[model samples]
Target: MYGSQPARTGRTTLLAVLLAPALALAGALVLLAAPAHAANAPRTSVNPVIFVHGQEGSAQQWQSQAKRFSSNGYRDDQLYVHEYDTSVATDDHAIAGLEALVDTVRARTGAAQVDILAHSRGTRVAHAYLAVPERAAEVAKYVNLDGRTAAAPPGGVPTLAIWSSLQPNGSIGGAVNVHEPQAGHTESATSAESFGHIYAFLRGRAPLTTRVLPELPTSVEIAGRALYFPQNTGLAGRLEVWRLDPATGARAGLLPQHVVRVGADGAFGPLAVNGRGHYELALVRSGERTNHFYFEPFERSDRFVRLLVSPPGGVADSIDACPGHTALTVVRAREWRADTEGDDRLRIGGSDVLNAAVSPRLRQILGLFVFDKGCDAVSHLDAALPPFDRIPFLTATDLHLPADAQARGTIPVTQTMRGTGGIEETIAVPNWPSDRHTVSLLFKDYADIPSGG
Candidate 1:
């Protein structure tokens, strides 16, 4: 991992060192090397890509794929994301928003046509858009990502339909199809394999690199939105970017690196920072709970970083928020399957939270909200709470952990990958009190899957 400054050995680093031999044996540390001609290759006209996220998803769903596209020679300006309110019943409003977005991207990039990539419920909107001959005429190609099934490519646009484990037999009429057995619904859109197909179909050539390459200077520009979950509505707040200790997830400095005023649009950043650094994105609002977000690392410049937040007594108010304990939201794009072998295991504070009752394969849960369900100061790892389980792509569990009032104690979280020889990653975060602060963590979905894995 690259860091702006020398990073000291922390608990997570020590654990990784202990597993080095296993990682080496599994070849999990190997990365795809950039081709010699990739950077200097002849350029071609690239159409701007507009990504349509699924139900209950945000622009952040396309973050990794956008970086991958940039690494493969797509200009940052050529990537666009259309955000909509997924809770709405009909696609009429979303279609209008997308049509306007398409026009805007076309005008900005001066491209004759644009490529459209739609995942999950977004596919429904894309299908509606393409129903109009004029709209279809404006699209050069389309990617149907783990969403609906169709008899033919909508509007006869050249299409690539990627099916996840949930839809092994799904396909689009007259379109090339691929099935990824290891990927879940969201992973089908974010994984590198899916990117390869998308790039090849639109560019008419294989990508020179599939990896998210690190920036040349090791410093990257980051920008994003702080929006209400599902609604995609903006919130006015203060955004603080704080560098964290790589080992313990404690603040590296007493003060934050940058503080930006978030407007009603929920947009912030374009701030430059170390590409490989671990940092906490804290959203502060007057008389409201502060939401803190953490990611693995940024290998390149990212513009789609989303900080999904809600105010007190909002959509997320169902969770027990207490001063005596910390609330946690852990997420991974890949589905957690506990019924089969080669399944993922997530450990919070050294206890595995993934199990048959909590993370069954059929659930396809991507996010987990952890808290003291009844505020009885008891932890139950056996089953998911009904309220969270009813929510799309999300689940919750009761876990009691006394907060460190001073925020000095670290809550160690570890995830052992399904494949890649049990590759283990641990991120320790500060134990912030739940009443005033909430913590969220993001994990990568894919690793090298062996044959028949």
Candidate 2:
């Protein structure tokens, strides 16, 4: 989706034009001596890699690639992402930001030079910085992903240009150009083929493994998506991989064995598991360790497991009824408000509940839901909320009840004005029947009472 205008090039002379500069640049630069290590030691460490995103892209665009780099022993701090506003920002502005970022990364990692990987419009920013001899001197290598520039070496740095059939192939003089006929623009950023080329170009050898895997010996491997909901197309979060004690089935410790970012596409891992035992994988929100989906590996035997952020009971099964009997469906609703007062109610609930008073300066909402024993808690729902709804209101729907079931839903309303505290009351829907189709569990005095409940 972030592809740019294609550059025209001659197909017959593409190979010669592309490799010329890279070969010359390789000869011009003096090679550093390798560190002394055992023959079986891991590959020699390379310079830190700075990723530049394309137009309308954010640092999150490189999540999968970053994880891949991490799997190859690059520490989190050694990898950097240069995020900039591509829409209104000029190439000079981006170049300046990149220059500062590269200096910071070099200082932090103590690397003499850094490698760069840019995609689509990001190629413009990277090329601009490299065109300057002073700035380009800090770059060890440049990997262009599905982006085009003139058939010349970028700042005389060794370059590898990867092109997808979705865009016309282009070349850089003295650089290595690879064309993958099946890969799309975005796929060029996330695919294994792309990583293979990038790893070889930067490290001077093929990757031992193209996919992310655990360092320890493993009998089985788990791979799949970690989604917010079963129906959700994608999710963005951190997956904390923890080891489990086979005997007690308890988590080993607070520290994660390996922590990887789950991409917006929801794909997480081909994570290695040591043996047949229970393991816990949590989808913790970025920066907050406590707020997460903590659960055991759901699919033990299958190679691919889809870990969904669902309530205890399964939703689909709860809605499934006898052949002739119909299940009851309800619309779950809540009230949300945020303003500059001492009173702010934030309610977040599912199988767990979190109710707290937020700062008066921040706007917030309290979303609460209740379900019968056989019914699962609401996880996936439509976005539509009742009137005067703010931008970030929470809505949970598609909750169903079995025949002859009764449950109670509660909404605790509290408000504070000035220094004194306001009224606090619990609004409850007691003995709610499964025969009823719609249940409006709203905050007191906020929603209109429905007729014929």
The residue pairs found clashing in candidate 2 are: 18-174, 18-175, 19-174, 20-174, 21-174, 22-174, 338-363, 347-366, 347-367
Cα displacement (angstroms), candidate 1, residue 232, comes to: 0.8
The 10 consecutive residues of candidate 1 with the worst lDDT sum are 8-17
Residue-by-residue lDDT tens digits, candidate 1, 37-92 = 22343335778789999998887778888877876656656678889888788999
RMSD of 1: 7.3
- Across 1-453, the per-residue lDDT of candidate 2 in tens digits comes to 111111111010000113356657765321111111122233335787888877645443465565456545554445666766554556776778788888777776568999999987889888888988998999999998888666787999999998876565577778898888655565576566688899989999875445433232332355556543323335568877767553332457868777898877666665766543445566666443222222222222122244444332423233322321112211111123233334333332221122222111222232333233234433333322222123222322233323224222322222221222443322222222433322222222111211110
User: RMSD of model 2, in Å?
Assistant: 20.9
Model 1 misplacement above 4 A: 1-44, 311-315, 447-453
lDDT of 1: 0.79
lDDT of each: 0.79, 0.49
Ten consecutive residues with minimal summed lDDT in candidate 2? Answer: 7-16
**Model 2 spans > 4 angstroms off:** 1-45, 215-453
